[model samples]
Target chain A: MAQRIDVKDLDIYYGDFLAVEGVTMTIEPRSVTAFIGPSGCGKSTFLRTLNRMHEVIPGTRVEGSVEMEGVDLYGPGVDPVAVRRQIGMVFQRPNPFPTMSIEENVLAGVKLVNKRISKSDAADLVESSLRGSNLWEEVKDRLDKPGAGLSGGQQQRLCIARAIAIKPQVLLMDEPCSALDPISTLAIEDLIAELKQDYTIVIVTHNMQQAARVSDRTAFFNIAGTGKPGKLIEMDDTSTMFSSPTEKATEDYISGRFG
Target chain B: MSTTAPPTGKARSRSASGRAGDRGMNRIFRLVSTWSGALILATLAAVAIFLVLEAWPAISLGGEELGEQISWFPEDTSIITFVGPLIFGTLLAAFLALILATPLAVGVALFISHYAPRRLAQALGYLVDLLAAIPSVVYGLWGILAFAPIVYPVWNGIAETLGWFPLFEGPAADPPRVMATVAVVLAVMILPIITAVCREVFLQTPKLHEEAALALGATRWELVKTAVLPFARSGIISGAMLGLGRALGETMAVLMILSPGFLYSFAIFQAGQQQTIAANIAAQQPEAPPLGVSALIATGLALFVITMAVNMAARAVVARRKDFSGAN
Candidate 1:
């Protein structure tokens, strides 16, 4: 089951400094929304806050509200751990739990919540997840080999399988293809196209062409100067954002004028 | 060691002499480093060879007499070359100390690395270091006079309550200078080394791996179980072996706290019954007859062999971990 997200006037901070300010947006259910920005513009920071992962850093905090289907994730007594299970994240660099095998990496999130699993159910989950990420054909024979033994592109796909296994309502990608080659990047873009049919997907990217190619809607974020908080410049239909005039900054960023 | 490329284009002539000077210095440094390592290995080999040479007479005895000497041990006191009791005593005391120290060391290591606040963790770590810095002689004197008085009664109480168990069935003495006393002292002495090493390893678990666990909906304890523990397993084994090495070869603390007799008992609670090989050497070497000295050297050689074997075993365990590894 997919979930819609409504973020209202959200301010993110690392310790005393405000990192990103007054972000208000709605991410529709079962749709692909891409966030594109210059480096250090708080695009990745904003994605982490979606899953309550921002607070994992010491002294980092968030203000205002991030609601998933009208339930405030940061409300008192709402556990960050529970918030994370509802929204899974794939990091920029693929992380496949170096200690685990490919099958184990796929089942890691499910196993984290349930200590004991029926063998048949575990096998089914692993197969379906790997198939969903289009990695099962490549890795089905050597399922017990260490996840670290895979190439960078395959490792990223394995991480996707791991993320999908948990059955999270919203899937967050923080520049998932930035570390990948063109072929791997294309593979992920195709996977995103299929994934949005069942899950609400929000991806952050530095590549404008990728945002245009994969996203239904695009949100542009920008930083004014060093030490200044990043702000959301504009949100529009991907076709409209690319072809029509909006803000001067968004036009500059997308049209290769300047960051 | 220097394989520097020649300067190209305009700068080639200007840099030529400087590159030659650098290469000359690198060659000299490499030779010096190689000689330094060779000298250390040569010194260690000399010690082992000379020990065997000096003890040759006692070791070369005919079959029956050598066999008798090995069995009667230091207790015989005539012809005085046996060592079975000393070796067994050393093993029992060190083994007991290892069992006592390992769990406590790991707990302290985990607490400092993961659970404690930054300031508190530093203070606790410093306190453990202080435990190591206390001279062994001070540890010995404290054990004999202050520590023994406190633990003697506790040993007696354990003997009374759990006396049916052979290990607790102590013939508890007035001063209670037993193998158990030596073990507790050794555990205290080795605790700091094990704790320090394990703490460093736990701290080295990659931040990426830790965050991966957190994002998988794992609680803090689950994160430690999944990531930290697997990563630190090899380090933990090596740390424990370091402590075990110290316990095996310790001299002064065992000399002062344990009563020296040739008697052997696997029973840890028995008082006034044993002495380790290192303690026997320190106490007997000065005034020992020539034959006694030879016997001591032979025992010393045995201790060296045992320690080397343990180090080899540790290396094997640590090496296997790379292939069977759960962590990068």
Candidate 2:
């Protein structure tokens, strides 16, 4: 079984400005958890902190504990590089290495870091990873083509495949469907559903319908006022959150009454 | 329902005049742009034609036999001895400078773009720009007085330590005027241009591409290798070509650093043995014999051709790898 991610009293800051404050959440293993909020509510910020991806930004800091399977990821001796290998991320934009071929991009995580895989094993890994992301049938024939030459949706799936090639226990996606067309969104949604069976998945999305449709659990986050920190308002099973949200802000946000 | 339409007799004529005025202004802007573009092309063509005309006399008087004759003057008032060595020197020095400058330029660019703090990078970039602006003659004087002496001891140390190698086995002499010294001066002269171009290319590496690599567990160095370097490779090559072009045409620095001989030798440290095309023309053009003048022009034409070929090759490489930006 995959390990769960535990976030305790997580606060995110960009320079001097606090972005997200007092966010506490436990992401279950083998479940699809969706983060839905208005723009600038720090849903992506919170998600980035889960895997220490936020630290990549200059002057961005996190104050809290993020643990994976009982190991504190932000401990002094821990390496962020190793943390990222255990928990992968897909950006809002699908950015496969433009210079690498499709097959190369798929196996880059393994080959660039490890450099010990045999040619036959690499080929199998590429095929299996693409197949796991539901992109093998579409791109198998053109494995040697540049990853940049793929369509937007296909490229996103290729990125997902690249992420999964390393076999990360958790996947963090920041608005993965926002850049895609409707058809591509459906393909990614389907892939996400399948992915949750094997790994823990946390996605931040502006699309409430997507959150309701695909997520096993949903966390609604919102900012209170100008210059205020974004906070998690409610989190529960997807159906319950939509049907009878425990908080009025969650109900108001889901029904389009107010943000 | 009954309705009444208002007349716009005065407003219609006024608006029509305004439209005509606007069109006239647009026409003037377009004409200016077109004329400027044509003038640039015409200037390039005029320069090319002038160089060819100046070189015609040497081209008509062949140098194939004169090369072997070893005489200073042609048997029939032709002069070719000076040119062969000059051309050889120019190309050799340029090649040497490129070899020395490329890696250093790349390092400087990478440091400025990826490693240095924002203000420090900008300050260093300004310093490089200042180096580029320093006059060529100033560099020549500096090479003769300061650089040559400072660098000679190092060259001597290398020759002593690695004298068994064919290149390092040259005799030590005063002032250290040699092809290798000339090449070093040329490298310093062109370093700024290469670093600036490479910095620009490195800066243009897509942020998302870098972030993608970083998000996927790549360290800073790994991100540079996977995302930044590959994207900037072609751009760096193009920048190096630009530097090479500058190095090939640089006259004063090479003239000061090299002993200026008409004989060609592979030993870079050998004084009184190397000459470059630009230095040759500068050395002899004032009181040159008629054929000697033409031959120097011919060498210039040859240098021009080489520079053009390098530029074209750089363009081709850049075109094939359009995604790579060579900005530092």
Candidate 3:
């Protein structure tokens, strides 16, 4: 069974300025959860805190607990490296290691972390990971080509394959389809539905329709003004939230009345 | 209505004049910019041509005596003791300096870019900049009065402990300035320049690439080793070549630190047996006979060729780097 993520009373700060304040949410296991909001609304910050990736930035800190499968990710003894290994992340842009080949990029996590896998096992892993991401047929013949040579959509799928190669329990995608064309966006959305069967996935997107189409549950966040912390406006099942959100602010944002 | 029509025509004429004035100013700016660029290139070309012309006589004279048995002297008691110990010493010292300075420069660059706090890194950077501004004569004076004396005991200790090895054997009497000491001083003097250039290159690494490495569960050291080092490898090589050029042309510091002789010997510990070209030029150019002066110029020509080759190699590395970085 896969593990669920529970973020409790989370507050993120950049130096002395609070970016997100007192937000709490439970992300169900084996389901697709979406965070949608305007720019600078702290959706990305909340997502980064789930895997302790927020601490990588200088002067950035997070308060409160993000627990995964009963283990507190921010505990004193917890290694953020280990936490990130279990909870993989994809960024807004597709950043495959330019120096590595397509095949090498897919197997980077396994090769970098575990040194004992045999050549045959590694090959099998690369094939299965690429197939799972629906990129095997497109890139199978050119595995030795550099990852940077691929098109924008192909590179994003390559990053997806790289993330899944380690078989992480949770995958975080920050606007994975934002940089893709319409056709690529549909392909990624379809991949998300299939991926939910094996791993918990959380995505942050500014595209409200993407949230409505792909997520099992949606959380809408908004900021009051400049220098104010972002706050969660609503969280519910996908259909109810899109059709009839409980909060007036969520309805106003969804209807394009105001951001 | 007739009066208004004349006033409107006057306004149109005024706007036309303003547009013409702006166009004329733009043309003047463009011409000045183009001339400035051409002037800079012309100055560089002139300097290169002048050096070659001044050094031509020695080059031709040395070529004529290439097959001589002893290279005893040219015409009119002008000793043509060319292609001997000193040129070899200069190359060896520069090579040693490169070996010692490269790793330290890269390490300091990595520290400043990835590890140090902003204020502290800025302070350290200023300190390095100050090193480049310090006068070469002051460095020579410091080497003679302070560095040599302080480092003498350490050198002597190594010699005493490892005397059985050929490289560590002490000289017969007083320990004089040798190749090893000169190489060490050169390394110290070139360290700041190399580190500065390398730091700038390392800082230019894309932030997204670094974040991607971290998000893949790589430790900080692993991230640097896998991503940062590989990405900046060519830039670091270029920076090292730049440092080597400086070390090769350095004169006053090497002259003050080395007890240069005209004999060629491979032994590291022997004093007054090794000398570099730059130091030799400074020491002998004043009292040298005409051919001796030409021989020194010939040596200068050799140094010039070496520096040009290094710069060309550095340019090649820099040109290929963009392809490696996937920027093309």
Q: Which candidate leads in DockQ?
A: 1
Q: Tens digit of lDDT per residue, candidate 2, span A14-47?
A: 9999999999889999999999988889998899
Worst 10 residues of 1 chain B by lDDT: B72-81
lDDT of 3 at B80: 35
Q: For residues B180-214, could you state the per-residue lDDT of candidate 2 as single tens digits?
A: 78888888888999999999999998888887787
TM agreement with the true structure for every prediction: 0.91, 0.91, 0.88
Top candidate (TM-score): 2
lDDT of 3 at B111: 88
Please give the lDDT score at residue A217 for candidate 1: 93
Q: lDDT tens digits, residues A33-100, model 3?
A: 99988899999999998888888888999888889977899999999999989999998888888777
* Candidate 2 residue A78 C-alpha distance from true site, Å: 1.7
**Model 2: lDDT of residue B238:** 82
lDDT for A75 in candidate 2 is 88
Q: Give lDDT: candidate 2, residue B136.
A: 80
Q: Rank the candidates by DockQ, best first.
A: 1, 3, 2
CA deviation > 4 Å runs, candidate 3: B1-41, B62-81, B156-176, B263-266, B320-322
